[model samples]
Target: MKFTSEEDTYSWAVEFGKSLQPGDKVAMFGNLGAGKTVISRGVCKGLGFEGSVCSPTYTILHEYPNNPPIFHFDLYRLEGGADLYEVGLDPDYLSQGISLIEWPERLEGNDPGLTHIIRIEILNETEREITLEKI
Candidate 1:
């Protein structure tokens, strides 16, 4: 899907979030400022979260208290696989709630079943192409 504005991108994410279930993992691949956090905010909204949703870059992971819980992770600042393990995000969060991971390329071999991978590409300053694939 092509998003012409941030709102458009967020709306798409809200819709996608409605279809998510517990124990589901969504891997989001995108460059910085590609609206990844916007999409995540929409997901939190759709999941009934009423608080702010920010990128967990420094914190590694942020947990939201929604119906099924939302585990938002950003691996941009992570140095290596050990960082992920140290955060207790390897196999535990995968089975606990809905996991949305940004910069998922870092988790190369940790393939959680029934995963949805969303790749966001910046076509231009006002255009973003998002492709969601399930594996």
Candidate 2:
């Protein structure tokens, strides 16, 4: 998908988010400032989260109390899945709700429940190439 602006990306993501359900997991892949959090916000909006959605970079995770709950994880500073444990993430919560993971490469463990993978490539200063695939 070619997104000429952030609104385009967020709009597309909102539609995608509406299709998610409990146990759904989405992994976001892109470089720094690639608008991962923007997509996340759109997803949360589509999921009926009325509050704000911000990046969990410093906090590592942000839990939104939606219908199925939203476990938003930013693993940019972490090394692997083991680090997730150290950060107080229960492996079981992943299956009970929706999950959005940034820097998913840090999660070395197998995530069979992951339902979607969103890869964004920067095409220029104002354009982005996004690929959304279902698992």
Candidate 3:
């Protein structure tokens, strides 16, 4: 799908979020300023959460308060899956709730339960293409 505005991207993500269940893991792919956070917030909104939904680029992880919880992770600064495990992004930790990971290419091997993947391709300053895949 193509989105011309952030609002649209977010709105679509909200609906996507509604279909999520606990333990559902999502991988988000995009460059800097690619509206990944916007989609994350939309998904949270769909999951009946309302609050700040910023990327955890520095902190690496943001746990939102919710029934099942939302584990938002940013691997922009991480090196590999070993770093992920060190930061508690292991299977045991991710199984507790929904997990949204950005820059998931850093993940080594196939982390279980990572069934949903979303990739955002920038078409221009205000246009983007969103692709979703399930494994």
TM-scores of the candidates in the order shown? 0.91, 0.91, 0.93
Q: Tens digit of lDDT per residue, candidate 2, span 1-135?
A: 999999999998889889999889899999998989999999999898989999999999899998989999888988666455565456686777899988888878745357899999999998999999999
List the RMSD of every prediction in angstroms: 1.6, 1.7, 1.4
Q: Which ten residues in a row have the lowest lDDT in candidate 2?
A: 81-90
Q: Cα lDDT for residue 79, model 3?
A: 81
Q: Candidate 3's C-alpha lDDT?
A: 0.88
Candidate 1 per-residue lDDT over residues 26-114, each given as its tens digit: 88889999988998999888888899999999998999988898999888886655445665576665576888888877766655453
2 versus 3: better lDDT goes to: 3
Indicate which candidate wins on TM-score: 3
Q: List the residue pairs that clash in candidate 3.
A: none
Better of 1 and 3 by TM-score: 3
**Against the true structure, whose lDDT is highest?**
3
